[model samples]
Target: MTAAPAGRPRTARWLLRLHRPALIVWACLVVALAALLLALRGPLTDAAAEGWRQYNACQGRGRCTYDQDAILRYKDFAGYANLALNALPVLVAAWAGAALIGRELESGTARLAWTQSTSPARWLTLRLALPAAAVTVGTGLLCRLHRLAWAAGDGRIDTAKRWYDLLTFNAGGPTVAALALAGLAAGTLAALLLRRTLPALIAGAVATLGIAGAAALLMPRLWPAVTLTSALDEDYPNVDGLVVDQGLVSATGARLPIPDCDTGAGCSAAYDRAVGYFTTYHPVSHYWPLQLTTTALLLAVTGLLAAGSFLALRRLTGPLRTAGAAAGTPSTDTLAGAAA
Candidate 1:
């Protein structure tokens, strides 16, 4: 085999050539989703909004007629788009773990690259950086488009998803991009730790999911919530957003959980001490704050994962490193054995 050129630019080109199929698939996915989101932001949303306006205008009148099909179509399209965007992290994780890192290590290709004047460190860095950049750009475009699509429907369509809806929330901000990066890092680390394809793929996906779940659980607390109280005689505060907590507030200014009482009399008795209801929530205005905070958190996790990948690479090639330093370079067979 011809000796591979030594330089970051040439290495990047080589990596791209090796991963062209995966890159093509990724690009296709992004472009397809981007097209869908563009429709949602423009034509689909307009039709749905028109349908809503017609329906609302015909309320309390005879022969109510509206473009119900348009409304339903928009709902279905938006739902699928949201779901696909949310699933991008898992797709990225699986590909990174199984194809990018794991397969190369398993097939001895990584060792071959290392023998061609590419240090294990540079090889790993290129793997992580190249995919990370692609993931960020692709995921970021999807996120922005999804956000715009959702925003175009907001308020205009009566059944449009709220800013707080988990699917919609995850699909519409920097959080998804951050999660994708984290997934790449997680996959890289898992592959390095396992040095096998299947196990690494599973571990990477699970790790990314665990990270996502943790971020979701902590999101409500990441920002300060607004507490709104309403007298019992009135309906609960009519605000719509991500609710942290809701319960009864006693006349003495004490918060209490709403007791489970079915019968009217039972409910009255259960709420006898309560004078009003209180709600703690993050309003629409807090959307950016929550997104930015969660992104910062996932980025931190990604950094740690990248660092761990490097450490695992060091441990895997310890003897190779010492030998290479002493004799200018270790043999390809030794690198392959270390990888195995």
Candidate 2:
């Protein structure tokens, strides 16, 4: 058995054991990323280049033109497509948090670890730190990718209805804000309530999924305070003219086809086209910041829940005998304690 080092708190002794699962998970994540890169890199890069070439060939004809700028935009947008692969890894990570405390409680393992050399708190804290670090770094990478998307695409990346449209879809977005908060809540709830690994794991999964569902549903509403203006889904009745918001030129700006209109009745066809195009005008410039603020609000809610979990974990030194018992958990142990 490994001995505790001199002068270190009992907490230090358990740190190694706590990090064991995290190390394994991180190693697996590395392998997965590597394999995915190897399998997808050639195909994805070629697709990006090909798409760029097509965009360049299609330019300025009013259908869908591609200039060098458009090519660069497509190239950058392609980098974040791997994020569609985000669900699997996220499922793994969300599970890891619950695994930290939940498993120990499951097999009566915590009774062994806690009494042998360390307090439950120390052991729990060490476990949380390892995976939390991994999430932090991993998400950071996602943020970088998002930044490149803006750069490579020359700021023309589609912000509407795109999966990566939200702030959390960027590299660090899921980890730092979503996964991290959910992980903490799941981990502690697993420990304080289930007191057993397998059940705790299930509970954690439910909690994570619940949060995701809730975020998708309610997060948009959180930014009513900061969302400058809502996108009006219903049409306006400027039948003779068009009303627009926030764009120098609309997304599909077409030249006015009607020759000098000496009067309103001159060319019905040209007027109809212009009116239709402008009526459909929906500027996306304000969309990004609105989305970002909403995500921040969701992150705040996550932080509050995680903090509650910390408080819950701190008071218990034993497995929770029932779901009801687990409900009482709460603590102020700090974020580091919920790391794994």
Candidate 3:
């Protein structure tokens, strides 16, 4: 009994040792990204804001004077940072599917571990738990730093992405962190199901993208969107935000599609019957509602995937296999034929 407890810790240590390279890579990624975000939140933001201010002041003065290079530099780095942050889910999924689970199973390493004092269930549990902890901490910190960087640019830099911009939105909140967790779970599940590194890696990455796409489709619907109506002559909503639905509203209050043609004769004919335009959108105030709701959805999916992985692992190894291995008996693969 005492040995069992000791063996569990050893399993964790063994996992860390096996994936030390991955740990180093992940740590370096987190540190580098954090530093980039801090730079964005401070110097880049200040420089860009100052450039905007100078440019605005020189407007209509004939010869414009501003630190254009600073603004361009901020724009370039912000795009890079957001891209990297958003790519975390797919990257994590590939790693988890190929290296964390599938490779071990494919190369017989997992079976060797299962035959030891650490049971298969405990082995799988540790595999999931330790990595999940690391993933959560790394992603959570990145999300916070990204959010701070984004907030620093908001209302300051003229070209800053709005809170509702898809890349910026996900990177700035808990949604991306939850998505990363879902990716890890999906990858683990895929590895267990496929039991092959290449197939699992592909399946995991595709599953994570599917999850992200679903979240995007469901996002606007998660919270009640506010509707704003404006005359056809006025700009839609008069604010920058996520527009759920926008169309012309008829005189009788029925919603209709926007005129197919741009301004002039055809558009005038199409819009003649309409009184004004109406927009259903999530304003800046709805950012948290949308983010939190999406995060919750992703987390729920992650839990389901993790649970499925456990169930799949159980089926792959069979019930008595681990017990037999624990009893110092030769462990026979009950589904050896199936595995082959």
Candidate 4:
């Protein structure tokens, strides 16, 4: 048999060829999402902001009215786009498990290729590498576009999403890219472990969802939070910051929930003076720190999963090597074992 190409580019090409339909779908999805974001940044946001301006200016008149339709349209489109961006990683995970790995293994295509000219290790590497590169590039581009669109509406559109909003936080930073890569790794591992398309697809999507949920829960704790203390009568400062916790602190040093006080009427004056409001939050400045920390964590998980995939492939191919040797057909694994 003719010798297989030595570099990764050839293997990458083969992997891409096998998954060309997925590649096309992913490309189209990215383009459509990006277009929507761009439209939101320019036309949709401008229309909403103009409506807000008209409404604010009409105050004190007999009746106040503005372009309610424009505002509603902007809100609906923005929400849909945000949902798409947040769900992109899960889609990647599902496709990776069902098409990229699970289908190949279930149909014996992977084993056939392994026995032909490719080592199991090489095949696994190419599988992971190609998808990883595509996911990174696609997700990274979307993240950058999302950040730009989000920033453009800051202080301009009243209905714009907040920095600390769940979907906004994940899409407007590196977290989306990290999550996408994590999904790819997770899906590959699930496919390898289950060796069935439907089961692996379900398991991979569920795993990705769990990881994303856990990350969202842990995000605020990744960095130290700043505490702001204020008199009970006064409102908490930094309303724009991401608030992790807010409660009342008693003079006796016990933390308590804020009392149901009606404009300083419900609670006793003594209690009001004794208890102050304490807020723990991460300011906007902490965005990079939080994003980088989470990205590091997700990349570490991806590395572990990749290592496990290669190890599992090695073990699975060992018996195949023995069978091939007894049949007098030198398997790719046997050739590599002998060379080593």
The residue-by-residue lDDT of candidate 1 on 1-340, one tens digit each, is 3443455467668879977898899999999999999999999999999999999999889798899999999999999998899889988888889999999989888877777666789778777766777888999989999999998999999899999998899889999999998999899899988888999999999999999999999999999999999999986787889999999999899998887777788688758999999999999999999999999999999899989999998888765543343566686667666855
Question: Candidate 2 on 1-340: residue-level lDDT in tens?
Answer: 3554554555555565657666676667655554444333344444455666676567676687444453454344444344533453345434654566666666666655554444555555666665666665654554445444434333233321243344334332443335444555565665565565666666666776666566655544433321112222333323321123221122246434323566666654444444332232212343455446645754676677556655666655433222223443323342223332
lDDT of 1 at 30: 97
Per-residue accuracy of model 4 over 1-340 as CA lDDT, tens digit each: 3444554466667777976888888899999999998998889888988988898889888687799888888889889878998898898889888999999889888877766656677677777776788889988998998898888778877888888888998898889899998888888888988889999899889999998999989889989989888876777655667899977778876666666678567566536645577888998899889889988887887788778777767766664443323554555656565323
Lowest-sum lDDT 10-residue window in model 3: 329-338
**For model 3, what is the alpha-carbon lDDT of residue 9?**
86
Each prediction's whole-model lDDT (CA): 0.88, 0.48, 0.89, 0.81
lDDT of 3 by residue, 1-340 (tens): 6988997687668878966898899999999999999999999999999999999999789997899999999999999999999999999999999999999999988877666555668878877777788889999999999999999999999899998889999999999999999999999999999999999999999999999999999999999999999987887767567989988988899998877785588788768888888999888999999999999999999999988998998888775345445555434655362255
Q: State how far residue 78 of model 2 sits from its true place (Å).
A: 5.5
Once model 3 is optimally superposed onto the true structure by TM-score, how far is the C-alpha of residue 275 displaced, in angstroms? 2.8
Clashing pairs in 1: none
- After TM-score superposition, the amount by which residue 287's alpha carbon in candidate 4 deviates from its true location, in angstroms, is 1.7
Ranked by lDDT, the better of candidates 3 and 4 is 3
Ranking by TM-score: 3, 1, 4, 2
Q: How much lDDT does candidate 4 score?
A: 0.81
Q: What is the lDDT of candidate 3?
A: 0.89
Score every model by TM-score: 0.90, 0.56, 0.91, 0.86
Q: Specify the poorest-scoring 10-residue window by lDDT in model 2.
A: 240-249
Each model's Cα RMSD: 3.3, 11.6, 2.7, 4.9
- Model 3 CA deviation exceeding 4 Å by range: 1-12, 232-235, 261-273, 323-339
